[model samples]
Target: MSRDTIRADLCIIGAGAAGLVTSAGAAMLNRKVVLFEAREMGGDCLNFGCVPSKAILSAAHAAHTVRAAAKLGVNAGEPKIDFAAVMDHVRKAIADIEPNDSQDRFEGLGVRVIREWAHFTAPDTVESDSVTVKAKRFVIASGTRARIPSIPGLDTLPYLTNETIWQLDALPRHLFILGAGPIGCELGQAFARLGSDVTLVEAGTALGAFEPDHVAVLREALAADGVRLIEGTGVERFSGEAGAITAHLAGGETINASHVLVAAGREPVTDTLGLEAAGIEADARGIVCDDRLRTANRRVYAAGDIAGKGALTHLAGWHGSVILRNLYFGVPTRQSSNPIPACVYTSPGLAQIGLTEAKAREQYGGKVSVTSWPFHDNDRAIAEGDTAGGVKLVLGKGGKLLGVHVAGARSDDIAALAAITMAKGGTVRDLTGPVLAYPTRGEAIKRAAGKHFEPVVFGPFAKAWAGLLSALH
Candidate 1:
């Protein structure tokens, strides 16, 4: 029997942020596009990852604020968390954003949407159970899933992953998390604020990617939220049934909890892609793609977590745009050419773009200049009574912006300005003298930048010049 075949200009696998953008762009350009999605429309970000996580985080933040309102002279009593209602908010967030990524929207945009898993049948073709697609170009944006570690006895005890945690009908009595990455930290704090006893165990330092000082602020915030963080150690094994589980630590101590959440990490979704059939190379990391996102099969490209470049949703979207520019507009663009910004969303959120203080010193040696402005010095933070950490600007030779790290409230919004400056290859001067509004969180960035120019602006030469002018006058 012959399979039904459809030919197109571009064929995309995955309906996540990366694939959706690529399909929309191509379809709107009057190009024939075929998109295959094995699951939901928005993939992990909308359904299981960013969207749901942030929604829960928002709820947790609200509860935390009410509890902390005594500092502002408002005695808002203890918050009573409705775990089911919180989960409802998470579901509602996904539902609201589902329409934009739905099959009807893409189909209306002239894309042939196939609701099935597709894999390479040949170098130029992909075949699913119901149909086959032949295309000029292809994209693999299937994204990723939670990586479950192989701890002894863990298999027998039921555990939760980011994908499965949302299914819980009630709050956990004691939540045991197996990782201390962003997901673990975020959820750990959220659950703790929601009155769940949360413990996070990590073999390495938690949020070690950020500066130690900034990490200290986050540690305090998480501790304040009643999250128990165990770093430099890990679970040796797990035991017990679904309702009651025990985590055996490396040093022999054990932790008993009502639930287990494995936020260890993410594994790229590349199962049964038949990459070898299409001459596309891939490994445990993800599909092997070049700086331009071109796979071993030059006709193919990758985006999102599957690209192995970055796992961020924003990075995924940027990858799609990069591919569109190269394939459609004939423009040369490299994914690495742009700067990436990352944020850990706690009370005093941590946002970083480019190198850290230690990294800058290691890379540039004697050329590194560090400038900082404490949040306590900022009028806004002082007024809010929540000055946790500050903004640190790492500068290289000629005052170039090597990095910008903000560890305070609204750090993401503040770091956004720094992200643009880094993307434009601008120096610290770009962040300086911006006429930023008085007492705003963003002013911290400007103040940090201004610190770099203080010596030059108030130098001996300037003082001499001023003296001469005064004498002449």
Candidate 2:
């Protein structure tokens, strides 16, 4: 058998959002671009992570709304859930978006798309099952996958990860989750709402990296939604028998579950790609990239979840664009650590952008101002009967908005707006002067901004305001 050889200006591995975007941009520049993918083109986000999860969450939300119809003076019974149909809806959502990332679409854009597992044969060359590709510059956007832990008897038990959890034909009678990160919390709540007994066990605290206050709010909501949240606990091991998996905790507690999900963390897909051939550096954390998303090897670059920074799809898109700018134009675009928003898609989705109160105080020596407003006080929230969440704004000494975190309805969309303001170095005054639409959740932003009014109004203008008011009277 003869090995095939192909050459291109740029070779990109992994046809997820990052690889696809990079391929499209390079092809537009008339650069000979070749992209490789081992499996699906859209990667985990479209196939397993964001798209499918959101679709499932939406169905769960509708079911929840139907159950709550009694409060609105409408007689509605409990939602009848057909698990297979729900899974179909999730698959349909992915299929609907698949064509945009199909191989034909990239081919139309002048990109050579190859479906194969590519490993580096040299710094400039990669060999797959069928062909060998060589290029001047290479991008590894292989993305990350669920970090499967080494638990005794785990291999014998059937388990779920974000990747295969969506393919479930029927909802498990009891689901035991082993992480309290964004994915665990979101999926746990959705399953609980859909009538599954969900137990979310966190090794540390729930939403461990978030501000303590935000965690408190989210924890309360999850508890109210009938999720058995176990924080600051560790899973000692797992035992599988009689078609069920039993998770033994460190404290001698055991949770017998029909299914076990390992949402602990994610490991970057850099290990199998043979980075040494390119002299690139990576570890369990991820590929070590500089500010420009360039690896130790100057000719190579990395982005998206593989970069191991912000793992959101939006950030992946942003990083992809930056990689192209740095690669093509020689314009060094640095990835910003600030103003990245992360959203948890639960009943009341938690959207967090910028810095948390703890982080801001740590960085600024306590010269930070924090203010918030609950959705219960907002008109839209009251009408919608989802007044369980709120928004928090963090600011530094110079009135620089450090972060805007929201946990409520449509928070993902709202957080994008907050990201824009924080990215531009916006301040409370910027939020104050704006007349937000009436009867909307966004009004909470303005309401939170109003907290700054008391100090300003009472400090220097207190006597002037009293005199003016007395004269008018």
Candidate 3:
């Protein structure tokens, strides 16, 4: 038997956001491009992760708002949730976004789309069932999947992961989650609001590596949503018979749920691809790429979750653009870990950019100052009845805006401003001097910065300093 060969200027593996965007850009530059994928075109984020989850979160938020009407002086009855309808909404969201990332769209971009798994057959060649792709440069945008832990008997239990959770037909009467990270917290709250009894268990304290204040806010919000959170505890054992799952805890307790959701974490999906043939180094985490998003083998590059540089879809897209610039235009661009923003899609979403307070204090020493202002005090928050959270700004020794953490309505939107400021190395004065609109959550940004003016406003030397300046004039 003889093998067939196809040649392209660039060969991209995985048709997710990173791979597809890179292909589109590269092809537009008149570089011959070939793309391979073993799964759906839009990858995990479009098909399983962000889109479906956010759709569910939106529906859950609406339901929660209706239930809270009594407290807002409007007494509405209990919401009758149709789980099927919720799933329908999720599917519709996927459908609406699918066309943008469909195979037809990529083909329209003058890139060859191959719906097959690719394996490296040589240092400069990859082989799939139908074609042998030869290219000067390659990109590994292969994404990640839910990482199910090795809890005893967990495999035997009827469980769900982000990949399959959206496919569920009926809502679980009770949902037991095994982690307290972003995914666990977001899904736990959403389902609980939809009338499911949700129990979330975390081995460490709340949302382990996050800031203490953030942990407190999330804990309080989850508690308010009628979700039972078991922190500082873990599952000792798990067993399943028929459809029910019983998880025995290390603390001599047990939790029974109609379904178990293992949102523990995610691991990169890079094993099946023949990386060793290309001499590329990777681990359980992800492909080890250099500052320029280049693999150890210079001919290959990586982007997105697979690169392990940043797990965000936006970051991945940015990395893809950087790779294109370096490979095509001969421009050198590197990845930066600073000023990246992430959000948890809860009610009054939690959005964080740059360093946390503890991190700032440790890295920059005692010269850092922290200031916070509550959303409850903001006119917009008060008017909207969502005065549950606030914003905090961390500044360096000389008023450099080190970070901004917001946990209130429109925090997600506010994060863009924070990212741009931090990336541009702006100071507190810049944010404070801007005249933000009245009755807006974004005013919290300016207000938090204004707190730095407190000493100038009422310091012990205020009168003396004013008199001295007046005399000098």
Which candidate leads in lDDT? 1
Better of 1 and 2 by TM-score: 1
Which of candidates 1 and 2 reaches a greater lDDT?
Answer: 1
lDDT of each: 0.92, 0.86, 0.87
Per-model TM values vs. the true structure: 0.98, 0.95, 0.96
> What is the Cα-based lDDT of residue 292 in candidate 1?
96
Tell me the tens digit of each residue's lDDT in model 3 across 1-473: 46679988999999888998899999999999999987899998899888998999999999998988998899888989999999999999999999999999989989999999998978899998889999999999998988988899998876889888887888888999999888898899999999899999988875665557766777788899999999889899998763578999997898888899999888998888899999999987799988888999888998889998767877878888888888888988787744678788887578888788989999999889999888878999898887878888888978987778888777889767777777778888888776777868888888888887888876879978888999999
Question: What lDDT does model 3 reach?
Answer: 0.87
**Clash pairs (backbone) in predicted model 3:** none
Report model 1's TM-score to 2 decimal places. 0.98
Question: If the candidates were sorted by their TM-score against the true structure, best first, what order would they fall in?
Answer: 1, 3, 2
Q: State the weakest 10-residue window (summed lDDT) of model 3.
A: 206-215
**lDDT per residue as tens, model 1, 1-473:** 57799999999999999999999999999999999998999999999889999999999999989999999999999998999999999999999999999999999999999999999989999999999999999999999899988889988987999989999999999999988888999899989999999999989999888888998999998888889999999888888998899999999999999999999888988886888889998878899999999998988999988999878989999998999999999999999989999998887899999999999989999999899999999999999999999999999998888889999899999999999888889999988857888879899999888887888788998888989999999
Q: After TM-score superposition, what is the CA distance of residue 149 in candidate 2 from its true location, in Å?
A: 1.2
**How many clashes show up per model?**
0, 0, 0
Error of 3 at 242 (Å): 4.3
- Runs with alpha carbons beyond 4 Å of true place in candidate 1: none
lDDT tens string, model 2, 1-473? Answer: 56689988999999888888889999999999989998998988999899999899988888888888998898789889998999899999999999998999999999988888998988889989889998898988999988988888887778889998986888889999989999999899889989999999998888876767767877887897789999888988999763488999998999999998889999898767999987889977688998888898887888888987767787888888898888788977788844688878886777888788888888997689899898989999999877877888888876778878888788878777667677777887777777778888988887887776667767668878988999999
